[model samples]
Each structure stands twice: as structure tokens, then as C-alpha cells.
Target: MYARLFPIIAVLAALLAPAAAASDLTVFAAASMREAMERIASGFEEETGTKVVFSFAGTGVLARQIEAGAPADLFVSADADWMDYVTENGSIDAASVRQVASNALVLVGASGAAALELEASKIADFLDDQRMAMADPDTVPAGRYGRTALENLGLWQSVAGRLAPMENVRIALASVARGDTPLGLVYRTDAEIEPNVAVLATFPDTSHPEIRYLAALTEGSGNPAAEPFLDYLTGPDAREILQSLGFVTDKVE
Candidate 1:
């Protein structure tokens, strides 16, 4: 009787030990990905019976944080450039990097603003009294793409004085949505989140660099749960969610 009871108690303890030791994985992602990624992470947590913690900001800032020893299990960057930065620095596995989603750059404006037909060449005309908002091009990929589009359309130099640089694309979108800035360049998904804003125009493919969303597991993450989350982001369910939020499914070139 003693032997049988002892074996049963040891098995129960073994089972409880793993449950108690299970860790919450930390994911650092770009500000633009916050809405969709949070939903996906919530679903992942429910399905896997694990906890997920997130930190969202500009990809450049997140990369710098990770380089400075921020404890993160996974990273989702707004573009390939910052993903490359972490990979090159040996902070994450290069082979684990995958393009998760793509986004189109769009010009947005307050819903109550004048209805203007925006063509690539006519973008500057829309910026007359309206301040145009964008993320800081020096630290945000979306801002760099917006700048490139403006330059390609011969509007960047002319509109330089009319620009409001936000910390991230999400903030730039917020400025337009709140009517603080009448116009902004942001991801199409960001515009979708704001009922007060209207997408005035999408940048022509030839007008700017393609925007790609990339993700990878961090190098020193002790959490083995990171891989599954990365895999889930590329799965059908996650893709469907992303599509519903206005993200493009195609990979950026």
C-alpha cells in the first residue's frame, strides 16, 4: 500500500511541477502590428495554455532595446531592415526570420475634410493647410517608405516644412484621426482602425519601397514557446485575421 501511494504522489508532483514552471513568453513587436498581433497572441495563449507578454514600439527602437539586453522571447519587425539589424547582431536567429505580412502605404485624412482626388503627382496640393504626419523617417520603416513615396512623386522637398514627425506610424495615424493633423501617411491597416479617418489614396507600387512585416525568435530566449507563436503567425488563421484588418497577404519584394 505504501509503495503504490508513493508512486501516485510522485506522478502528481511531476505533473504539477511543469505547470508551475511554465513561463510567459515575451514578444516585442512594432507599433503598427499591435492591433492584429495582440489578437493573435491572445488566441495563441488560449490554445496553448500559455501566457504571452508584449512590448510594442517602432521596429528600430525595439531592435535597439533588444541589443541593450531587453529580455524578449520573440520580435516582430515592421520591415526587413530592422529584422536584419537584430539578426546581424546575433540577437536572433537569421534562419528563423520569416515574412509574416505586407502593408501598403496610404494617404489618410480626417473624415470631415474636403474630398480630394489624390494622384501621385497631386499629393502636394492636398497638403496646403493640412499638416501631413509621418513617423520619424530616421527610426521607422513606415516613415522611410512614406518619405520614399513622397520623393518619388516629387512632393518630399516641397512638403518638408509641412511635415509632423511622430514617434511611430500608429501615432501618426492617431494625429490624423484626432484632426490634429489633417493628413498622414500610414499603413492601410492603421487607417482601418480609425473611424474618424478616411483613406484618401494608396501609394502606387512603383512610388515607394515595399513594406514587409518580419518575425523571429530571439537568440537567448529560454522560452521554447516562441517558435510555436512564430509558426502560428504564418498559419491560415493568423493570415485570415490579418486580412480582416486590411493587411496585404503577399510578400514584399
Candidate 2:
């Protein structure tokens, strides 16, 4: 009876060993970083045996979730304001925050749409009577960038009522790709991935505040894997992927 019990105990220990040692990481990231983040996380998982899970949404929404005590190991926001929001609310450690990447805004249209130079005066001509798709200007980073760009170009008042606001930049990109909207405003990196769309023109950097993506480990993150994952994002491997994807990685400090 003792020998039989020992064998059963050994088998149970073997079966549960992997589960007991496994580590998982949960990351909240801006919707724009979804593709690049996933690719980087895949490598991270392979290297460290940590299972990475992501929650991708607009920066504002993700920050709000983090502030409300969401169980996220990391927070990667599209702009500093949202990151600041979570930090101020005691959701993430301010010292852990770092800018990972930067991007430019662009005007996008259907892939086959005529290639025309877009300027403040010609925005209406490009859209004709149709609407311009953009993220919700009231809160989303992409939308705020778009609104500011238009305002800086003196085009906001002309096209204010013609805006078709989506929940996030990805949806705004889709609206243009699917021809649901005549044009869209999105990050240059977003325009690069959508084969069904074409970048009509890039907005000048002066049109709005600098676009930056910030990453941080959340205050509530208890996973030991979180720190390693955060380091991976700022390390060389992730930098290469981010640059290849059209994100301006020079400011990744």
C-alpha cells in the first residue's frame, strides 16, 4: 500500500509541476500598437516561457480601465496624457513609464482612389460631399491629433460637420478601407498595414502635438514576468520590429 501511494503521489507532482511554474503577463496597449506588440510578445513568450495576453483599445479607454483597478501587468498608451492619467490615479508606477515609439498622422483614402496632393484648401475637394473618418475627437488620441491637425491647417471649420467619428483609429482606418468613408485620419503606421487604403498625404508635424507611445508596468502588477516584458519592449529586438513597422523609434528612450 505504501509503494502504490508513493507512485501515485509522484505522478500527480509531475502533472502539476508545469502549471505551478508557469507565468502569465497581461498587457493593456493602444489599438494602434496591436500588430507590432503581438509580434514582439510572440518572441518574448518564446524566450521566457511567459504567456502574454493583451487588451487593445483606445488609449483613453485603456487608461480608464487601468485607473479603475483592472488586473493588467503593463500599460502601453498612445499618448502621454493617458499614461499621466493612470499614473496620477495611482494605477501605474511613474518611474516605470517610458516613451517607446512615435508616429505621424496621415490622410488616407481608398486604395484605388486617385492620388491627389492633399492640402488644407483641398480637403473638401478630396472628399467631395462625403465624410472624413476619424476616431472620436473628444477622447481618443488619434481623433485628438486629427482635430488638432485640421484646426492648425485652418480646415477644421470647413470640415467640422463632415466628420465620421469611430470608436478608435483602427475602425477609422477600416471605414476608409471599406469605402464607408471617403477619407480617414490615422497614424502613418496604421496606414502602412492596410492594403485596401492609400495614404493621401501626411500631416505636418507642426499641425499637432508630437505623437508618442508610452509603456509602463502597472502598480498592481505582481507578475515577475512583467518587468522582463517591459524591458523587452525597450530593448533592441522590439526596437527593430517597431521601426520596420513604420513607427518612428528614434524617440524610444
Best by TM-score: 2
lDDT of 2 by residue, 78-171 (tens): 9888888889889899999998999999989988777656465588888888999999898789999889988998889988999998878999
> Which stretches of model 2 miss by more than 4 angstroms?
1-22
Runs in model 1 deviating more than 4 A are 1-22, 114-125
Model 2 TM-score (2 dp) = 0.89
